[model samples]
Target: MKRSIAQLKEWFRRGKYPTESQFRDWLESYVHKDETVPVSQVEDLPRLLNGKFSTSRGESVEREAAALRLKFDRHKEDADDEFEKIENNRQALVAEDERQQGEIDAQQAQINTATGQLETVRKLLHSGASWTTVKAAFDVLGGNYSSLWALANTVKTFLEASDTSDATINRWQELESFLQGITDTDSLTGLLETMKQEIGTAYLNDLRKTADELSGIPATYAELVERRARGGMLPGTLYRITDYETMVANDPEARSAGHPFDVVVMALDEHTLSERAWAMHSARDAAGYFGKSKLEAWQVWYCLDNDDTRFQWADTTRGKGVIYRLIDEWGNDCPYDFKNVQFKRCNTTGDFVDNVVDDADWPNTHYILSPSMNGQADMTADETDYKWLYTFTYLEQMQDVRDASLINEVNADFESAYYNKACNCNEMQAYYIGEFIDDTTFATQALNNIVLSSYDEENGAAVKMYGNKWGAGCFNMTFHEHCYGNSFGVNCYCLIGFKLYYNTFGNDCDGNTFGNGCWYNTFGNSCGGNTFGNDFYRNTFGNSCVGNTFGNYFQYNTFGNSCNGNTFGNYFRYNTFGNECYNNTFGNGCNYNTFGNDCDGNTFGNYFWYNTFGNECYNNTFGNDCDSNTFGNSCGGNTFGNYLQYITAGEGVKYLNVTGGSDVKHFVQNAHILNGTSGKDSKNLLTVGLPEMSTVCRYVGQNTAGVLKIWVPADLV
Candidate 1:
């Protein structure tokens, strides 16, 4: 049987060479044994049998074989042509694949280069390099001019807010100028170097200044006392009564009496005591008891003695004389009232007694009466000359005496209008000038401003301003309004707003913190903690949101904003709404729901979790555990979960849409009806076959009111 040409073509197409036995059978049929063909013709026989050939009658055997040979040659030529075309096509395909792969590799290389450049720029920015240096580096790496310009502006703003030093300000100015005039990369590099040097030096100076400012000053007297008690030295010296006694004992005349004297001494430092002694000695001649000539040695004592020993001086020579009577041991007093009494060298033996006369007939003129002891004697007679005589003793004896004279004098000085105006006096100086009893000038200032008030130094009346600006650690703050605690608003002006905590404000605004802006009808907005927003009309949590704009009537929402008409219930967290959402209502615990622009009129019930709805999806209802439900654009009247419909069927009947619409309704098994809507009487109601028809037959249908009604069988009822 002759094989078909279709079989040969199929074999050639499949690249299947014929078996040797099959090729031999076709060769024998083509050539007769009697007529021996050439060896070349026989070798070509197998090639002839492998291709298409024809066997026709009424021709010689050779002619017929030759015709068949010609046909087989044409088939073999066609097969070679087909093979060549297929090989060429395959090569072309391979080349095209290589070309695509090369393009992809090139794109990947470019992406990697871009990523590396971005990382380099980020590292440079965080390396504390100046903005100019970073910009220059970016330019060297072929960064765009607009990005460099933006970076420069950002750096300028950051530096201005963070650093207030003259060097920083000057460097920023220079950098701004350099950026504006930048024409070449070389100039930019030079500018970057200069800016880096300036910033580095300024940073060092800032550190130094911070260290100095943080090293606080010792301001209180208690601190000085504590330091001295610990055997530590203070910046200034403190004097005690024993120091004064030691100085008096060192004097030869004061020690020669051989008996202890009762003395009340104001023991100040040597410099201060010397200044007071000179002022007192220069005014001693003007004292009433002293003669026209200056005393060889004048000692002024403020006698804190008992009433029995104290005596008052009587007026004698108009302005120049005062006399105190000397009583003897027998109670006999001196004659002439001891007129113009002056202490000469006493003839007595005791330390203090040797300073007085023993004889009653001698005018008893030896000791100088303390101005405090003598009523008629002027203590400030010389430049109110004896003002220290009264003030120094008053300050020393203040602790023992109730309503001490020093307290009245100091309070009087503080109450004076000229107290702050005198010289360039600070608050402490204006109040404490009277307390410096060693200085006569301040004593005069204190005495002139004396006022009779019930307030004493221990009470609130003696409060004085000590420092500038109110803070958590300041003292003596003035002009503070609505302030609390010791240091709040110490030196601040008009701090009258409410709910402040260690924060300073430049202007007034209620219920906001740290940030400065005007809020009109906003509430519960905390601008502290780096969350900043301002100028909200009637939105709650407006300033509390981070980088968001809340329009009017936006309430009970947080996090992302630009929510114009979205009405949210309480407990909404991390929800973001675009500007196109209008009249969208969210229930409690509705979190992580992102509504795109134009998503309007969507009502979400409680616990609507993890849903992402597209834009323009209006009138969509969502319920709890309705997880991963997505709505397309313009999709409306859609109900998700079985919470929105009524169903009372067998176990398999899960979802039913009573109100028919083109929208898709999605629900899970075991879902039941929530609140249903009014619809047709008997729409597409689905039921499932049960195992057995028990006495109970439940069916879901619409009642006369067109609401969903579940009916029960009579036996089950």
Candidate 2:
């Protein structure tokens, strides 16, 4: 099987074939099993066949074998190389296929999310055609719609452009407007599709993107509100996004001024934009705490039913900034901002009524809080107030300051009010005379239920106009009952004061003192001689004259309001003159019986009690009834801001007589003492009414501070 070349090569390397003929026989034997049984070996054999052995060299046979071996090795190498190349190509193709598949998968995910969101938007839009509903749905989109619309408009503008002019851009815009004009819900889709066909896929894609964006943005608006809401957007205001190009195209002046012409705010909701008209209005911050609390935040303001329609806002134009105030009714601590607060007027309805809301014409809702209060008040903004606003319609404006250095001359304003003459005068007096429209009725209620100097509404503010000594002396008040609003006393007895520390004559915040020109705070007093305090106390079930809501401090005074003689447990401190006794000798606690009304000018020996404990000897003479005619916890407020207070040991604190100048060393404020009662740990109380801690001084000679150290004669005891 060896070729001639192979046989020749083999014969050249080998000295000789064992025999030329043998070589031929061997080559012939190997030819079938191996190729390249060389022609060289065959030629040698033919030489041997033609003539003698000398004709052919054995080298030919050796060359033939070597050639055969080389051919076999080259063939094996080629086959191995081809196999490796094929395997590498297969692996590369598999990798490329997998990568392409991953890209396709990502696109599939995008489509899924988009489909879900589009479905949600569709559901919201289908709910209603009302602005409220649409605005609610728009909140779900956050604000992405604005961006999308901007992008689409930009494209439309570019598309409308011609090579030389803006003709193409204008055409694209006109097509958009035409599409917007399709009002019939059933035909909207068809028209959009038609427009899509005209504007092409590029523009439609942009529009879809914009709508989708608007459907996904979060809501944001008004600042300065309480922050807490977390629902999707509450309500969305409609904003007209003006295209800058069109605005500039229409108004060259505005464009040149660099004034904003795009994105105008309007009062109408999204559903109202069939034509472009804008009206800016202010709104409460819906996203604030009120949004989160839902109903609780709405309970703070008082209401004025549509009863009194006398006055109106200073301005009557809508959409202008305005400020208004809510005032406490008449019986309210007049000038004292009695729960009244100022606010911006953001809403109103109906036509303006140039009438005044006075008590005579107050609406039915005009009412006053009951004197008996225990817990929180009711929460109903819809309730009709006993009163109404002077007027109910108007708008406001803001004054811009062009120069900071210019001094603005503004008059300082004070609130005031007058009440019915049937009431005794309150220490402080002021008035408010804005259109009573509704406050009049509320004012009447406030004055009606108040408790002043024994002046009951049934009896009047007072029958006689007492001179100087009348904390209840304001009987024939010159001011008309419904005349104005201010603090002339008689109403909410517990007058609130705005007195700053520097105010020597004004009712300030640093607590009122005697002779400082401030009035007393009677939570609610209607007349002189009025003695019942329904709101001052309370039991565990929340009922009493002066509820626990207030404290017990009768500091710097010697008597309370309304002494028609039915008062008890009331306290007194600095001021004097209402009791009947000028001098008392016998201890008064157990000595007095009935007082007040007809018992005045009574006298007794110095040994009798002048004011046992307000009714006996603590501060006055005598002339009050004895139901509980003594000062105690249920009578006054916690004492502070003054000296001398708390002078007893039984319930509130331990007290010492020290009447005979007998025991000054053992009767001071804040001194714990031993109880007279047996078997009880009697040293927990501290007395409060003297110059120092005399309780400690009582045991200066020994470590027995709280021990009972004073003993009086049997008669004195």
* Candidate 2 residue-wise lDDT, 1-717, digit = tens: 354645656664657655677567556656546566665656567675678554356678778889998998999899899999999999998999999999999878755654556544444334324434544544554434443344335544554455644676577567556444334454434432333343344446667876844542222222201111222222343332322111111111111112112222222232221222221111332333112221211111111111122112221222111111212111222221112111111111111101111212312111212122111112112232211111110101111201101111122331221122211222234322234533453221111112111111232222221111112212111111111113333222322111101111111111111111122332223322122111112111100112111112222322222222222222322322243322221111212222222122222222121222323222222221111222322111112111112223222221222221123232233322223311111232222223443332221111245443432124353
What's the lDDT for all of these models? 0.33, 0.27
Give candidate 1 misplaced runs (Cα > 4 Å). Answer: 1-562, 641-717
TM-score of each: 0.18, 0.20
Report model 2's TM-score to 2 decimal places.
0.20
Residue 305 CA error for candidate 1 (Å)? 58
